[model samples]
Target: MAEGGYIDFHVHLPWREHDPREAARRLLAEMDSAGVERAVVIAVEPSLKLFKERVNAETIRKAAADALDYLVYMRIPRLRRILFSPEESLNEHERILVEHTRRSEDVLEAAEASGGRLLAVASYNPELGPIGTLERIKGKRYLGVKLYPTLHFCTPNEKRLRPLLDYMESEGLILIVHTGCDPGIWELPDLCSGARPSSLEPVARRHRDLVIVVAHLGSYSALKPGIYFDEALRLIERYDNVYADTSAVDSFLVELAVERVGYDKLLFGSDYPYVTGLTIADFVESILRMNIEWRAKMAILRWNAERLLKRLGRL
Candidate 1:
């Protein structure tokens, strides 16, 4: 931890059933131990309940629409009351909305109690319709919105997500999107095809003012080598608002990011909890050891993200 302290641009809390307080506490402990000043806790949307293991465009399109419908209906107070009043008795669709909504509230509560140590971000399946989710994010304390097209089953440039991207630009909210492959043992490879970084080119070009983050540096597991790193790098180089973070990757890739993407468009992020091999301190130290200037390291570690957050009035 340098004098400015490290700001983790990418972090996650438990997505499954768990105690919110405990989850927040675990994150804080990691921050304190790693000398992290603040970490953005993202409210994650539940994964898609696809009927087939092999996902097709038509199936994804329908699922995306269904996801949007659920999020939109969730905005109704009576619907929320009715569903949550007997949450234990909810069906699959009802449970997804209830769970995602509750997760958003939980992160907000944790951030409130964090005393400035934890910042919150909200994520939704953009293909599902960003309007409802974007509307849900408006006026909230969350500094940004996260989109996981890979797991949630959609692409960044999907026709349905245009309005949501527009809303984010006007509202001055940052967007941290997962733009790589998911090779988790339990994941469906077919569903992740849409997470490619190049899929975002259309939206990035359309909304030049919107701040976009390509997480994991567009790198993927061994199962999918050379996935979208080139596309992510091109996006960062092509658009001033486009940025990338070093999360769930190795130091070699960080070196490549610094050499190729430069420090201004790069942010430091320890994917946390999910990164079992290294500690936050290890990631920081690796950056320190890079063959780059200290100033560049400082920007990646804190100032770069701080500048973005300050513009959004999140700081």
Candidate 2:
């Protein structure tokens, strides 16, 4: 690891707009400006096969209706209270899934050319089937697999996912699960029900040896902030192997997390490209300006992630 620079625990490559190499270059330039020594670039794979199997015509119709309702609710304050609707519709999610599918190969290729400045974490969708997915990623230098429970329309504890989970545990690969809320179609609570932090408890309990990192600190919701933060704290406090990333969480909440759980289990993450209006430098500066001691700030910014990377033999 570099001597004195931030190790971002979360970031993503630009979607289909840029190819892998150009994406890596842009990401590296951003990191350089932010004083980030390295970053873990997580791939986002919204499988069409999974979407087709899970979503029917009725679901689409309901999504369109809900979307219209959400728009109306946003325009009227009374409707906002009465409906309590989500910001995104199911139809929007379908469009994103179909149009913005990111492959693990793209992420790996980008990181390969990043001169060790980026670490790749592959995305897995169970709809592709475990045997083929595993075979495809076998012997590839991915640090771990990232699972999107809400987007994939499955929970972490599903029996079908056991084979993949078991393989990750046995192979010493970390599991980064998307907790809290997501944007686009998954903004609806019903669609993203599996994203709640509590949903991961069964998996954490069953796989004691597996290292699990909950993304977004269980509070990435744009409409309902910190919705599952307490549950995330519960998992971190109860399970020795469970950790969290502070991506897209409010600064006050980041401070609150330190107060509740300390800095040891919290990793710095910018959720880059997705964090509108703020640069990676802005996220790093926020941590630096916190009221905590320098040691605590450094732990969150660098050392904590460094320790994890070293353990995984990636540093």
Best by lDDT: 2
Give per-residue CA lDDT, model 1, range 198-299, as digits (tens): 888888898988989888877865444446788888989988889888877667777777788688988888876556666777777777888788888899
| Model 2 misplacement above 4 A | 15-17, 56-91
Provide backbone clash counts, one per model.
1, 0
Estimate the lDDT of model 2.
0.82
Give the Cα error of residue 175 in candidate 2, in Å: 0.5
Candidate 1: pairs in clash: 68-128
Tens digit of per-residue lDDT, candidate 2, span 1-315: 237689999999864456899999999999989999999999888777777677654654455466564445354332242233422333445676765666889999999999999999998856676666677677888988898887777788877778888888888888998988676545556567798889899999999989999998889776677878999999999998899999999888889989988889999999887776778999999998888878888899999999988987899
lDDT of 1: 0.71
If scored against the real structure, what TM-score would every candidate get? Answer: 0.78, 0.88
CA deviation > 4 Å runs, candidate 1:
14-17, 51-102, 125-128, 185-190, 224-226
Candidate 2, residue 24: how far the Cα is off, in Å = 0.8
